[model samples]
Target: MSGTISRRSLSSPLSALALLALAAGAVTACTGPQAASEPEASRSASPETGQPVGATRHMIDNGGHDLAFYVTQGTGPTNVLDSGGGEDSSYWKDLVPELHEATGATVITYDRAGLGQSDAVPGPWQVESAVSDLESGLEQLGVTDDVTLVFHSQAGQIATCLAQENPALLSGAVLVDANLPPFFTDERIERLVAFSQPQLDAAKEDPDDPQNRQLLSTAESFVATSTAFHRATWPDTVPATVIVSEKTPFDGSPEDVQRWKGAAESFVQAGPHRTLIAADDSSHDVAKDRPDLVLEETENMVAAQR
Candidate 1:
């Protein structure tokens, strides 16, 4: 959770609903086959959720916005490593390569708008737009593989929405301590919105600074986070598992842990294919604290799919 990120890198906070994997946590996933020699049809290829061949680092043109994304090729079903909340793709450093090696499938990771190298839209950030970018990014990349999406913390909203809307696109999913939309009530949403407003105000005042822009970007997106949860409908078709952390990181209260466990239990128990696991000796970042358990669940999901 502690590392030196060069000047003005406003990475999502460690506890702000996010998690990461590893494999040379360096910047720029620019290494792979050169895309220049590929045909236009091949380069502009992937289906909405399919994987692209011979493409590594690239920018996506999604409705006038340029989103920075990168892919590490592998084998099996495409695994989409999406971190939650203020996080970008870099957070999943430790887990990425493990899954890639285990599944032998192309792993897709990227910075959401304004998070890393992705460009920010001018208007206030919304959940729907963020999800749109992900779907569109895959299509633009010309990916059409069966995907097993991995979501953590706040990014759970995107997972649920996608599962509900496009069940056929996903083969299975892993909720790595994900946030269940139904668990967020009115009181919770108000508190989160309130906590983020001050930072947003300060960033607006100093809009020119890089740090300020980063703060502004997170704040704007967070504004609608709760509402997105409210609007989301959990899909019944997506076979998934909810991995819960025994140690509390998002909240310190004993009640919060119980609440999370309760939500996770209900989420997985709703369907026969789903299950819940209480990750032992783990924090919110379970992937880092207990990589074996995380990898086990991931591999299990792939096996079931196969």
Candidate 2:
């Protein structure tokens, strides 16, 4: 399942984000492609409990990004968990092992550039750079195939781009309270751009300030432009599942929530190979607020694939 992507096909950050929001909801219209048959029940691991209990953690240099990752190998599909904004690889600490135990797959979790122990890049974080880093990391780890990408928040854009451009490298994708398409309007885009200037200026003033630097790094990483919004559409080949958050508000308004729902619904309607699950008690941090629900949905999705 080797996949290739042309540099020319990559979408701008705003475009990617828009397409992601659209693709994220379009899942309901898409059908799951026939996958290879799984082993008998006796051989399959329980999704509720996860895999045997050991994990190996390491740091790898993907280009210049110092990516810290943890691996738990299983007999099923490989799982790559992408952390949310300002979060590190440890974001999945409690949930990853549980997922591994239940599904019996090779599970991997990593810190994005500038977050956790990984060093941040010098400029604003560009979507292309993040994708490149992820691809490089996968190549370095040698788990290019048999991989299922689980993304949270803004990572949805990255995961969407990877699936669209390099579908062969992925088995499937799971999005947790992710930011998607249609969520970006001209006004929203302007707001995002406007919101980032202060942080950017702050970073410019004191590049060494950890808090200011982190703020600038995160803003630059995704919201610096509209490329992410435009590239959010799926290619109709990849399978996806979106776990929607019922409690958190991206913009803290009903109108904003409706926009988010519209974007999510767009993704579901665009593709047949998708599922939408709602988490009522949790906010954006689905993993932290309700690990049990996240684990359950993850199990269901994986089992369905198996």
Candidate 3:
């Protein structure tokens, strides 16, 4: 639909593939909390919203690499906000305070490897490794239980794997227009790979770029990763809230729009605690468009846990 795909689009496996295919040459891309009390230098105020940015910044080691996380300390259940592909913790800057103030729960946000202030890791991006990065960060922060994860876009994949692998680490989840297993059927994967071929070829010209690196890495393992992801299940023990955008990631194609919405529906229907909320008049970036709703639902989830 649009002439170009934003880096945030990279979060959705299919959305990025389809949009990248359409744009071909016109793609623009581009946390942790911790043991620290240092103020963030680069982040202070949102130029647009003027909201104060994230709290104290800290860096933690994930294996040999460093990942950045920011924390706004509170007392209740911890709310961990994760961005989609090509995005960092700053994406959630505005909402971080709102969430902390409303729920009084510590709000933690981080940059994935190679994005934001986090160290770059060579090779393609792997879901398992992303899970490890999150896992390591949480454990190091002494956050072992009662974490309410709020993930958007591509982070959904990581959230899905984490839920299955470490249900005990999470109390509830808010999936903001994230990817789901039902959407990654064999046919969809085939179509996604086909559409993404042009972008994959384009990425080769600048593989060193962070955005390109992610694209290359994702393309390298998408087939197998998505296939496995499709087979993976979310733990029924974890309560989840699924927020589907009005114009899902595939807003350009009416056919894809239906499929994306249907997949989210299927994901919610399959579980008991899982609930689906429609984000009206929003694009793929639901948090940006409907911060109120995101905060409301997230606070509700935290309230439910208490």
Candidate 4:
């Protein structure tokens, strides 16, 4: 925990242990924060509907800071695509139009605080803040009900909190290779924090780096946040579809892999409308590896809602 973190602890330019920190609902910097002073506005008139296929970007004021949102025009049952740790709204760029075209549902994607075009707030990452951003952003967008939330990885924590706090706002959800409360057991959280410590320490070297800043933010509140998350539960009334990748985020460790998949299984089993689908030939990033599967499941969920 005091030295260089092993690659097996996580991966990539963010840090060797970013995934571990990410699963713990900490260290959200995958590609770090980029300077996005203004939201880019782009649109192309669609041939079929004459509506804009490209996203109409908006910089919504959430408290004092701005959270960037890309909204595609369509009908009701708004589909919101939220990215994982270290990612921004652009992560869903490829899937937005496809979803909108298929379901004729208003598609939305946004950058979390500290990522993409959004303004970053100082201090530790708070799930409550994340939930507030979504709630307020939707309210400002005039999105009231029948919302389908599709989220991945670290965004799962936000989804969990949202379901508990604002279950009335959502019609359904699609969780793609997301971290679950069952996976954040006490022993698992201890190991995750331990694995993430070295990376957290390394973050201090380049304190100004946005990625490091995010990693550092976790140092103060990761354990507390993750501990609280472990005891949190998704409402049984909210129907959910869980897509679990074959090679989980912890594919490097067989023990963790089983636990990860087990969590998804347990989650689905605990509820009435919950379903689990296996992404047979994918890794932790199932959306990228098997978007067809993700799309299929999401479309099914949306159809069920209608």
Candidate 5:
């Protein structure tokens, strides 16, 4: 459940059985070297992993509501990260500071309202509300300089929507195992949701929990916004790179896997600036499974800023 963003599928494009298998396999399948990049061995990388050495926490007031965010100050561009559905800043625990160490850029991570250390907000879970929380947080943090966005899982919707609404604020983007909004069809999602009904019911019973709130919000509102986003013309001005898992996290049939890759390829064509890279032998929780690739793709985005 972490994308440096959560492992939550905004809507799985595959069958429920496959996704269940994918989740079960994701835990044990990635046994290799996903333990952050080697650059993290630097003195600045901090041994604690999640808590960076010099990072400090701050609260941004969104009309009396506070959004919790962290800052690891660096010298170059600002790298702002948005975690996937049901996750908060902690999702990026290991990668956040390591990223700053690698790039010498200001690295920021935040808990979307109702998750992590942030306060809760009422919601049908509208993407607009999530985007607003981020905007206020960034503005309050004085992010007026260059910016690169690293969005994971459900946060992909937020990143794309933000780019559409506030492209001027961004220089480049890295979509890590992000939601391919254009590829989700209603028939597929309806089936996936119906299959996930049991989990949804459990969360519905405890709706106040952060993950639950995020899950409910995603179920209620995220897809429509994502669909609408795909309907609009993609923003071609900003460069974006998509990092996908080499192995399907939600285990699908061979045909399912091929279709998923096909969709990823199509998504890469959204703009001339878009590129798609498949991480080696990873699952849906790709950031955790292959932190090295996440670091590399993010660095690629930072370099692509124009």
Candidate 6:
């Protein structure tokens, strides 16, 4: 998939109060490595060509949370990764660096607020607030332009919001097993409420319990409360690629797997500048379960952009 953002355009600066509100809203909303060997074996056959690899890990203050990200520096547009629901940035631990090494494009992965090292906001994890936090975090990292966002699962929605409001900042987006907006139906909302009730009840019982608070701050509840906000704010245009998982659990039926894949495929087909790939060997956690596949697909996408 190919998409473009006009570099000639400029983003309106956020007012100080708006910035503070973004920060404050964020504050009130939520509440990897590798090694190598077999050098001689590689020498037996010509060594495989690969891009130079360089990565740095750092913590950035986003709102009240200390968000952690790994920046793999290279040429051209940077790839910003968004983790799946219920996962930390480590979701891309093995795959991102490989993509960077193979493609020579900068790759970034971060823990969202309330996940990993980042602290949770107080209440209502809205998508708009999340997008603001992302924009601010990217600004803090000095990566304010020419970005290729790679979003997994529910993050596709947040990425769409960012690209819509600030198209100049994004070059492209890849949605991996992404959750689309229109998919948020009343049945899904009911399911989310059912999924979040226990945690919400626990948090109500004892707000001081960090564990309970964290559980209550799940992405499901966050999406439920913020769906309207997302619906109201649509972007002008953004390029995207969508990937679907084809494998299933041992106990899962073929029909169940197909149903899940169908949902993902629908989202991909619905978007402009989108392509869908069904990874047969992988399940939901494609990055972790099939890093090679993730790396290969990412490299292909980045190369196409070039």
Question: What TM-scores do the predictions have?
Answer: 0.76, 0.76, 0.86, 0.86, 0.80, 0.69
Kindly list the per-residue Cα lDDT of model 6 for residues 52-143, writing each as its tens digit.
13445556665555665556667887888886545666656667666777877788777667766567777744567778667766776677
Instruction: Give the C-alpha lDDT of model 6.
Output: 0.55
The lDDT for every candidate, in the order shown, is: 0.64, 0.62, 0.78, 0.75, 0.66, 0.55
The stretch of ten residues in a row with the least summed lDDT in candidate 2 is: 27-36
User: Candidate 1 regions off by >4 Å?
Assistant: 1-55, 194-225
Query: Model 1, 14-116: lDDT tens per residue?
Result: 2331221111111111222222223345433244323334446567767667776667777657888787656666677667667788878888887887776
Please give the distance, in angstroms, between residue 231's alpha carbon in candidate 6 and its true position after superposition: 3.8
The residue-by-residue lDDT of candidate 5 on 176-217, one tens digit each, is 877665555554455456556666787789887767666666
Ranking by TM-score: 3, 4, 5, 1, 2, 6
Tell me, what's the RMSD of every candidate?
Answer: 9.2, 11.6, 6.6, 6.4, 10.2, 12.7
**Top model number, TM-score:** 3
lDDT of 4 by residue, 57-119 (tens): 666777778887778879868999987777777667778878888899999888788877678
Q: By descending lDDT, how would the candidates be arranged?
A: 3, 4, 5, 1, 2, 6
What candidate 5 gets wrong by more than 4 Å, as runs, is: 1-50, 253-256
Runs of candidate 6 exceeding 4 Å displacement: 1-54, 195-212, 219-226, 229-236, 247-259
* Candidate 2 residue-wise lDDT, 28-95, digit = tens: 11112211222334222244323223555455665544655556667767888886655666667678
Model 6 residue 126 lDDT?
Answer: 58
Q: Please state the error at residue 38 of candidate 2 in Å.
A: 33
